[model samples]
Target: MDARYARNIPALTEEEWGVLRQKRVLVVGCGGLGGHLIDQLTRIGIGAIRAVDGDVFEPSNLNRQLLSKVSLLGISKAKTAAEHIHLVNPDIEAQCVEAFMTKDNVQALLADCDAVLDGLDNPESRKLLAAACASSNIPYIYGAISGWVAQAAISMPGDHLMELLYPEETVLGDKSVLSFTPALCAALQTSLCVKLLVGRPVNTGTIYYFDLLNQEFEIIPFNNR
Candidate 1:
């Protein structure tokens, strides 16, 4: 047993740990949710990670972004993710792409990944990612945050959850998340990723919603055309 993952035992069977060490996942965005997602994914021992982000850290990101800090304000999120991943878990294969996922590069960026964890805030970008995952038969773990609220969902290929959830006119803005929102949401998203990778039964095509201040948790079910 690798002493590094000894703490994961009892919770994760030896077989499951071995399984996780052989799989790869792509984490899109490296800001609030992406920061936590990358941290959790690396600590959990996912064999390989491909982190994609184009934005550099700024003063506005300090409040909620885990990899953000005073001395690293001008550093790009991709560079920070690479640095953090190597420092946290050097054995795991890590690749950081210093660009946003766009229509032209989305497919290539997503290639060879077993699963994808969403940390992007824009609906259009999420739509692009969800579409690529659907086409490639990769499991997509959807995560988002707004103020005290966040939502997670699993969109298996052919589910078309993104299309059904976001209309063509969906505009991206007003994403007001607290300091803890991304951490909480990323935990849920990580759990879903583990469940899927470990062959556990998971609810697909459903949004797991959370309202922290109001203490409300709801399951919003939807269907594809």
Candidate 2:
């Protein structure tokens, strides 16, 4: 166990520790957002972690993905993230899946998780994850970025935040994306998941945007319900 996390989490009461013990969080896509989310959650003392990412490390990932390193290239993202978490906090039960999540693996991957964190790169994958979470009645913290802009939504089961937030197919298409955007979105998604685990509600059921070029952060609530 790292001294920092042990000191930061403090000594929990039996009940408090019990709450953390039962939490199983599944983080999909160990890219930029997933890397940072796993890093933070493991440090915060989450009981168990299931990290999934089909992608291997590449040179392009160095800028934002936390787990990417020159020496780590060609390694599995999930494995790298899991190893890092263990080094940071041995108490957390971290598992890594080297394959991408699909219809076949969605249920199995998400089966025991109390919450699902989406760090997916494209809408197709995001759609699949969202559908799985919705059908399972699990909450999905979704985030995406395109260039200088980022968008995030906290989709509870049955809410379908993406559909509500972006009804236009053109807007939801692949053309809208930026490098820095996903990093920002992932940060928000991770924050929301942590809040949920800590027994808090994030009232902003909307898409949050961060314009790095303009240096503006805006929360746009979708009252479509």
lDDT of candidate 2 over 1-225, digit per residue (tens): 345545545444444545766799999999878888898788768889999998899988887788889999999999999999999888899999999999999999998789998878777787788889889888898887766777777888777776665555735444444556665677788677767766765854677778888899888777764
How much is 68 displaced in model 1, in angstroms?
Answer: 0.5
What Cα-based lDDT does every candidate model obtain? 0.92, 0.80
Which candidate has the highest lDDT of all? 1
- TM-score for candidate 2, please give it: 0.86
**Residue pair clashes in candidate 1:** 147-176
Q: Tens digit of lDDT per residue, candidate 1, span 1-225?
A: 878899999798889989999999999999999999999999989999999999999999999999999999899999899899999999889999999899999999888999999999888888899999988889999998989988999999988888888899877576677999999999999999998998888898889999999999999887854
Top TM-score prediction, candidate number: 1
Q: What is the lDDT of residue 90 in candidate 1?
A: 96
List ranges where model 1 is wrong by over 4 Å: none
Candidate 1 TM-score over all chains jointly? 0.97
lDDT of 2 at 176: 48
